[model samples]
Target: MKRKYNPHGLPPWLRSIRNVCGQFIVPICIFQGIRTLILPSILDVLLLFLLIAAVIAFQFEMI
Candidate 1:
């Protein structure tokens, strides 16, 4: 008998994390960009920086 092969190889947890990040981070970035264009405030800029840092951390599986 021959063994079957699976095409979808990524683990479930990793796939979920990727989906969540893609769904959440992309929208947050887009919204931040729009907000910055409309009104560039110091607080918003700081928050945007923090958000980008967080995304980078998540991408590296740090958080």
Candidate 2:
């Protein structure tokens, strides 16, 4: 087995935020794909918020 390293060496908190955003976004995408009723009402809204927050965090380097 081989280990890979990131050259930028992101901090632990940034990694955590990225992981959390991925977790939230995946389920929302799956739900949207299924054409669920909640897609527009809830999942879409939640996904939008999560994406906004993730973008801001990355932009400001606050993660």
Candidate 3:
């Protein structure tokens, strides 16, 4: 059987860190996106992609 996921199952410190990251991930994604648009380097694009994925993961509580 598949078990349910619970955010409270996490330790206090880890949960706090996840909360902080969830709050900041959007702005960081925006900044990275703008930076990628202006600069368009390979690394910048890669970073932007990673940041976007992180945003998705955080939003869906898949992290």
When summed lDDT is taken over every stretch of 10 residues in candidate 3, the lowest stretch is 2-11
| Clash totals for all candidate models | 0, 0, 0
Question: Candidate 2: worst 10 consecutive residues by lDDT?
Answer: 30-39
Best by lDDT: 3
In lDDT terms, how accurate is model 2?
A: 0.61
Better of 1 and 2 by lDDT: 1
lDDT by residue (6-54, candidate 1, tens digit) is 3246689967886687569857977997898899999889888888887
lDDT by residue (tens digit), candidate 2, 1-63: 975555258888878877677567555555554554444557666766666676666555554
Pairs that collide, model 2: none
Q: Rank order by lDDT, top first?
A: 3, 1, 2
**Model 1: lDDT of residue 15:** 74
- Between candidates 1 and 3, the one scoring higher on TM-score is 3
Q: What is the lDDT of candidate 1?
A: 0.75
After superposition, which runs of candidate 1 have C-alpha atoms over 4 Å from their true positions? 1-22
In model 2, which regions exceed 4 Å deviation?
Answer: 1-8, 36-63
lDDT of 3 by residue, 1-63 (tens): 988888999999999999999999999999999998887999999999999999999988988
Q: Tell me how many residue pairs clash in candidate 2.
A: 0
Give the Å shift of residue 9 in candidate 2. Answer: 0.9
